[model samples]
Target: MWPTVSPQSRSSPSADGAAILRLEQLTRTFAVGDQFVRALDGVDLQVAAGEYISLMGPSGSGKSTLLNILGLLDRPTSGEYWLAGEQTSTMSDDRLADTRQREIGFVFQFFHLIHRMTAVENVELPMMLAGVPPAERRARAREVLQRMGLEARINHRSSQLSGGERQRVAIARAVVMQPKILLADEPTGNLDSVSGGEVIRIVEALHEEGLTLIVVTHDQALGSRAHRRLLMRDGRIVQDVSG
Candidate 1:
């Protein structure tokens, strides 16, 4: 069962009116040359707080486009997006950026850590950008890294870590801000099975800790960990299954 998180108090809105994120007739289109491609069309979706969902699709499916819109990284072409009870369809760029920074955490197919920075420092990027005080930032970063089993690797730069280690660092950084939702785009796509499983465990642990997680992946095994799965094809969601 999902929590009754009103739009004001939760990160991801729930479906069945328990939503933390809501989309009605969501659409996204791109103009390429003289042709228009509909990446997403008439999509209606809702994600409640703390639900772990996987968005799955084939190569040309609209999974990435949907994730972008849900993460506030892109806007819909002709629909309404209600995030945390607030209408975001018409927010200014700056306002959307600020809200996104505050409410969404993102992980990608490749670990995007700064090679020059140590693990702890990398995880502190969000806090740093949010103007959190230096002392608090350091402490919070340390706490989250340590929780992610990176206490010993905290001082290691990305160049010095293994793929699994790097992914862990990225996860730490993504969750450090306690965003309402974590958007992972093919997060385990670049890792080996062992490393990939490790990364998935880290993400699942976060989801268990009450974070709403949406993973966009082509890997069915990886996507199965989520509580729900949304399957996409040809710019539409064809199926939604629950575990």
Candidate 2:
């Protein structure tokens, strides 16, 4: 049985006063050759606005699968998912895409910056895709990149930046849209200790600024820093703890 978590565990005062996300009997399965693999098994969860959570487990523990679903990158095989009081399971593809772009900010483990684009341009891509005016996109991109400490690197290509700088660029790109929820998957996995520490600090700072943060990682130190921690095993969330 999964451990109990009180609704008050959310703790943070949210502007919306409703859970940012709610999952009911969430599950994801894949057919691997002749075998059917269950990536997530009957998982249920609730995430309030401004909460910081860490999901930790060994490989194949469903952490990444959960993140993918939360980020709207993948649909659950069968279950209900609610985002900001809207039921997502029944949303059309275009609607889903629109909701994702407007509500979710994803920071991938590997910096997925376009190699040929400059840092500011990379950060502007989301706004462009969302049909924001070109002028507004450029202005917002510059503002977010500057906030991320990338003002001087704004014109640098991804290949020209250091690992830490690249990661910051990716983060800037993720938040450029001002999404309410930030889903980070192994955010510090590819960086050296110092760089990873800096990245984590920035992420935590965002949490302090009231972005609902959920992180999937194998690093114990980073995971432990979250106000709530979940441990998964074999497609199930075996433990959920909150302070």
RMSD of each: 3.5, 5.6
- lDDT by residue for model 2 (16-104), tens: 35688999999999999999999999998888788889999999999999999998889999999999899999999999999999888
Supply candidate 1's per-residue lDDT for 243: 66
Candidate 1 has a TM-score of 0.92
**Alpha carbon lDDT of each predicted model:** 0.86, 0.88
Candidate 1 on 1-243: residue-level lDDT in tens?
Answer: 121234433344345645788889989999999999999989988887778899998987889998999888899999899998999977999999889888899998888999999999999998898999999989999988888888999899999999988988998888888787889999989999999998998888777667788999989898887778999988888999886
Best by TM-score: 2
TM-score of candidate 2 on Cα atoms, chains taken together: 0.93
Residue 109's lDDT within candidate 1 is: 82
lDDT: worst 10-residue window of model 2:
1-10
